[model samples]
Target: MSLRRLLAPLCAGTLLLTTACSEGGEVAPAPRADPPAASDPGEGAAEILADMSLEEKVGQLFVPTLTGTTPEESAEVISAYHPGGFIYFPDNLQDTEQIVALSNGLQDRAVDDSGVPMFLGIDQEQGMVSRLPVGERFPDAMAVGATRDPDAATSLASVTAAELSALGINLDYAPVADVNINADNPVIGIRSFGSDPALVSELMTAEADAFEAGGVVPVAKHFPGHGDTDVDSHTGLPVIDKTRAEWEEVDLPPFVAAVESDIDMIMIAHVFMPELDDSGEPATLSPGIVTGILREELGYDGVVSTDALNMEGVRQTHDDGEIAVMAVLAGADQLLMPPDLATAHAAVVSAVEEGRITEERLDESVLRVLRLKLRRGLFDAAPVDPGEAAEVVGSAEHKDAAQQVADSSVTLLRNEGGVLPLREGASVRVVGSGSEEIGAELEGMGFTLAASAADADVAVVGTNGARGDAEQKGLVTQAQDAGVPVVVVAQGNPYDISELPGLDGYLATYSSVDVSRAAAARVIAGEVNPSGRLPVDIPGTDLAFGDGLTY
Candidate 1:
């Protein structure tokens, strides 16, 4: 069947099924259909934009950070450009109660003044990138990828969307579509599902579908791809020099899958892909890439938002604000985290008034943005029940789901010399940065588990040892003070393990997620054998780790 036919019934069903669950078992089911077909939200957005002075249009283009500002200050900052949307930061979050109230208040004010509901969004990527003060975080994407289970990914997203939706958040910036190409990739390391485009595509598309099915929009981010580069976009622009053939085979396939899956939005990256577009600007601002390629060739009609403009990657390099203007002229519908809304607004408005950015292009973008909002039922939907925010934020079900993902994601990196599967109550010294309990409630669960590192037969070293050089040296000295053979685990970055001292065994989980931590814990306890192998190779290491033990 054609996608449209399959989707039409779903979209129709979604609109018809508005049954809310009444504080009981078996939550309400989804529309069982595709989301409502995309359409312009009428002349409302354009009418408003038309009435908007150049300043307002500029504001509409920006989705600014609401961190570090008072309610009044928040109002003032947004009031300046009347930004199109607002992205939540850690600062804007405190607890479920505060977040719900704040989000509702912000959206209310924007609508009352501007007559349009602002897109309230969060980067609730579950595990590591969560913004909720206390809530469920599923295993990292790598874990889901490891499972290679699209249903698991979809279920995880469904639960996440339901929780975030109850708090009044409409957009989830997640399902990092970047294939895990660079194993040592500092930022996207474990954040990615795995190294294969097909796997990442399938898992992410299912998750995106689940998000939309749950009434929250899913945004596939850091496009054309952030998976292959060695540099972090947060600090500097990383150049991907792969040829068109390689990109099509690997880097670009996942995004193509996501678009075909009908993802609501795409967040473009700021990295320079010299082979694809040698304009020396990030894909976010490159007209050739945005308009000529994404729109003309790829045929994606969804909103194209920029990665945070505050990042040095794009901010330091672009002078004429050439990238921002060019992106819209190219085909993007939204400008996210703009460096300065007013400046961007003026540039866009002046360009439009002067015909540099044709009115047709502006209309096209506004139409897409408005259509997305309408499809989300933003304007018609009632405000979330603020009182119930706490009840829903990090409910027991959510946390349990998170724990399950964590456990399932844990992989045994390596076990040499048949040292694993140790006898119970064996003498062990545990030491590592990731070994410490990152979870708050796990302390009470230690009756069956080891209460402390000294209680074990094996000495394990972990990343929690030292935060800095001074602290790191103190960690080694502390371990030596214990006078036990130790196995060290590196959680954050593998580079720090180069100087690890007084360790008999070494393991790296690459993240502090409960699954990896628990895997390390289980390895020490001898409850579960270390059968999984390392997916990424560490430089200068003689050890070759695959997906499973050799013996």
Candidate 2:
């Protein structure tokens, strides 16, 4: 499918507001749960645990994305397996009113049958990763790293969680713990904080605290790290060949920090680490990685979830049944987006029957999942007021916060030949694929968006995919065709700049968001002096770290 079609459900306007009473209508924030009281005996717990059928237990292991399924379909799916949790994609969300109806409906089904609330999750990492269209989009992890303010990170996460929890979402798949190592890395570039491991660790801690404070469980993800690889796991697998010391210093720190800060879950990366696991398998299914290292050595007892099983990294190598069996044997507590439920469920059953996966292991995940549910007060006699759904989406306060993040994250890479500070009356030609971002951020800036090559004094262009030799050739042609004082913006990587034809100036903000566009606009308009430096070496022999032309 086309990218737009793929993202349509995600970016669709499903979260429309209704005439429901405002959740903010003088209702005080819910009170936090006190420590379990002595008077509160462990009553009915055994019978509740005992009533679970094998299918119900197996279903608890799977959390699928809600796509191509209606509320009735969702209810049927839940009824069949009695899944312990449900994760939402943009398809599941429309507006607050619809989502509220959906969530309440789903929960009502679960309560009517099993008498337990289902865990609701979303990828609300804020900024580019946010699933909530109207919700706040904070600057990416890199921007938080750049700010060097833990409080800012905490505040951003808190606001994100408050909005998410208000919508009945209990879990946030966020706080990317990966450290940015490869500038040209397809997926985790801007998503990570920076190249520094310590900074990422600190930021992740702050995010976890903020999420928990707002009554949302934070899930740190893509462990041990996806930042060093150049390949996108969405399409294919990538390998990281780091020594033990390298991992300890780089990839492992942020995860350790997150664990220490009491983060509730971790999503394992699919990339293989040959150095750590001799089996040459992705870390998600490696017992040595997930069980031995993360659990035994590092002392993390929280939930361990796999990244989407449909991702080519894992799918290409194993069938649904093998993947499910291996993941549980490897000590993963939950499986996300497995392609086939029957096969996966059967695999777990087979493993249990064969003694490869023990009842204890199943109980381990069950207890952990139950603890989270208990903390969320799912067992408590509380009513979910459907009218409160409007409060779950973007509010005026959230949008303003998101805008601030976008504005602050803009960084300037380079401006030489004094081509910048463009003449006030000079016509400018902006040519690029990310027209959406440019229009959103720079439309109000002095320069007008040029429709053709002839009507401009300066030309701007952007590269969409990989940052290698192919991009170099394309940049050169665009610069020559425009035939003006050219300015190139590398949205992904700074690689191959030497290949692009001579230009009066070049800027690298490393992303194509409104923030990056705003930064480029300010630099071109001479409103802000260029201050951002190159974080990685360009793809040439001469360039090296700490040697690039720092603006």
Candidate 3:
């Protein structure tokens, strides 16, 4: 059968299925058709899942983090762990050539060993959490949220999906569904798509749809929400004080939307919620939250993944080897970046053998893993052309899309006395982490950088780092002292503006990445109209969510 013919029935069935699930609870099983043909990839996936041996099936549930870059270097670890997937970091990626070759070799080795393709996952969240050293970068999640434009969200994901897929990465741990309601949230501040539940849901769901259209599986992270907490899960477990009603009203909506939209994976956070689970265990190890609520109440039947298992949040409580078993028993399908690979894998295997973990439960997760890999086209095509990776990363089209998002995401919180949109040939003084990029961009836009702050028509100072609030305060104080009509450009957190008392202008890019910095400069130089509204509010200011100035 032709491809369209094969997809036609499945597509209708899928829509009907999701609609039914959304309207009510789970739908009844449909009538079975005749045995599927070999050409149907869905059936092929089922066949492969059924034929897998115990070892291969078990391996499909583990996705260990590899320390090596080369296939030869990683061979022993892959051979030993036989993970269904691997997550790569900056250490794993040297260049386009090296990483693509590494993926090709690993996939080739996996098929050779177990006749299964490995899923290569990357945390390409783009702004704060970028894995690859060089790719078309976007402004952070909050910045995209500032745009409040679903098109911008989709555009960024489309570029990201193309770049990652070309690099042989099948899964992207992105489109953070976490709404950053708490400004003091140490880890998930700008990483989330702003604080509003409805807005965050809209952007994140749009991002997931874009990723699916752009050829990658989008994993919505920190499920049941990580927005309201003030602690970092990587260090210590943050406890949420909200009741179940509050969770449903605030944090749970995005995850609910994602699952209802057929999102591929929902990542569990390591934060402890006393209301959800009184056991003191993080969601990663709590069957009450993961199985009872997320699986049963929430109606999310897709793969449930845990955040990095090596993080101190879950690591401090569970034995290194035992975390995997607990997470699986808690209803997690994939264990990500376990601290002790050999021990974790062995313990999970031992649990299965000892009837501590049921084989039926194990296979359910493994089969979902296999079906996801098949949907990613991994079974049909595992190895990507090396030349394709070289040609695609940060390509001109992607760069254009990145620039469009950044420009659209430029939110101006304060432009007291019309201090912005400086004259075309105005002299502007730029300073901060990305001063070079901002300076060059301003110069390119017919503005000249002044030799001194006193010489400039307007002093544009860029300040970042949430922890360096004091340093930014001093800069703002000094610039405010110079009295050169100081225009503060917030590169990372919009909250930085609050550190500066009185200012002539305040602009936020939400990041210091190249495209974002350029967008800030463009907005300052009057090259682009600043249309982005505040995704987050600057504390101690009149600015609130949905506040932005247009000139």
Candidate 4:
């Protein structure tokens, strides 16, 4: 089927203004549960615990990655491992129908065999880490931060949660609470709110509360903090050398806010902290950080999830089975994206049977898992209907809300030096990687694209700042040298503009999502006012944090 044909149902409308809803209605935020007590499973919790076998209980701790878009396609693994739920990757997604059907089938099979549902999850944080893609496009966290409106993040989480709920996705590993303290931090730049602890904490809480209010479980991530590291953890573990006092001041606030706001889970990053644990274990495998600090000291009785176990950060040092055991021992409630499902499941099973992991310890995780599922309303609800999913997934309202957020997030870093809100019919020459898409979009909006920089009145270039690649910078440099006023659109992080300081105008959209892209075009073309303030500092420029210009 054509993409529009498939996307229409899932990505048709934005959200409606309704009461007591996940979509943006004026509802009292959901009640935050105090840290979970070990015995405090809801009514009939004991009976539910009694009915579960050791293997089944172990399955609930694992949110394994599935390789297919259908339950039948993934049946063998699902049947063998009996994961607590599944975390979908791009590999498992096809189109809208396939994913909706996949979720329904998975839920049906789980209930038929185990009498309990599973937590279907995705890292739909928007921007760089989005999984299970389709429907309304949202600006990433940094873009939301640029707006400096917690409500924008709330709206983002609201529509996102509504879409996931429509697709039977109960959990979102989202609202990345990491404060982007290090400019060179590879993974968490645009994913974080901003550099400030207070801003990150405030926006993180607002977004988490919105997700919960929208009937989706929001997970705050990279506990302790992954924002200060210069290395990418997906390849190797980077050590954080911050003192305990420094961490408490800078890195701990967002997580504290998340826990206090009753975030459903906190995804643990795999970075090593020399101060917290001298044994050299990454936080994912460290009981000191996970149990001693997060569980006991912080008193966050919510679920604790590991970042994808398959990532080389934690995978290189130990085998999958060992990682699974260690994660449990560390007091993590859910195991996310375990690489070898069979090995991890089997290891956990053996750990329990051999008394390496006590039954009571296992139940705490299981009870918390099931309790989270209950909060997500998975038990009373039917599997997401494939037919109705389209209505909610890409509703017009969601698209509009996303565009509004994107528009508000468009930060003008250096626009006063030149002119913006370029006239609609101006001869604009757009040249850069992915410029054709923007050119086509602008062309459709009645802006004429000049054949070359020499022929155009002005030149606009689109590129990612986080990439810091020469080719993207080279294209803009050529335009600047050609005597054309160059307007560089920083599509990822705004830091890349540091490489090309002579530009007449610079805009940071914080992402390349459709809404962000469209917002950039509108703001540049004078159609929409640029309201987004800077969420992060531009390393080599005078634009400080929280700077923006509007026409």
Could you tell me every candidate's TM-score relative to the true structure? 0.81, 0.82, 0.91, 0.90
lDDT tens per residue, model 3, 1-551: 21112333342244211111223455544211122335664566676666566666777888888777788877877666678899998888898888888888887677555556778899998898898986788889988899889998999898899888888888899889998888788898889889888999999999999898877889999987888888898899898998889888889889889978989998999999998899989999999999999889878888889999999999887797788999999999999988888888889889999999999999888878877776766765636777988889989988998899999999987887888889767898887668899999888878888987888888888888634567767766766677689998888778876657778998888887899999988888888999999987667777799998999
Q: Clashing residue pairs in candidate 3, if any?
A: none
Candidate 2 lDDT (Cα, 0 to 1): 0.69
lDDT per residue (tens digit) for residues 1-551 in model 2: 21111222212222111111234443232221111222322323333445566566677788877654345667777777677778888877777766666666776666544544677888888656878755656666766664556876887898888777667677889989998887668888777877778778887899888888888888998888898998998888898888989988888899888778767899999999888898968888999999998899889988899998888898877888999889988989889988887678788878887888888888777667666666555545243455554554566776666555444444444455767767675566666645456534455665666665557677776654434557545654765676677777665545546566465666655555555566657666766555444444555545543432423
Whole-structure CA lDDT of model 3:
0.82
Backbone collisions counted per model: 32, 5, 0, 20
lDDT sort, best first: 3, 4, 2, 1
RMSD of 3: 8.6
lDDT of each: 0.67, 0.69, 0.82, 0.81
Between the candidate structures 1 and 3, which one is better when assessed by lDDT?
A: 3
lDDT of 1 by residue, 143-189 (tens): 67655567768868988998888888889888798876664576786
RMSD per model, one decimal: 7.8, 8.8, 8.6, 9.1
Task: Give the winner by lDDT: 2 or 3.
Answer: 3
Candidate maximizing TM-score: 3
Lowest lDDT sum, 10 consecutive residues, model 4, at 2-11
Question: Given candidate 2, what's the lDDT at residue 313?
Answer: 91
lDDT by residue (tens digit), candidate 4, 1-551: 21112222212342111112345443432221111224544643454556667777888888888876678977776666667788888888877788888988887676555656778888899877778667677888999889889889899999998888888788898889899978888888889989989999999999889989988888899997999999899999989998999999999999988878778899999999999988888999999999999988888998899998988889877899999999999989998888778889899889988999898899988888877776666665655667778888889999899989988899887775556877657899997745876787788788899988988888998988624587777888788788978898888877887778777888899888877888888888888888888877777678788888888
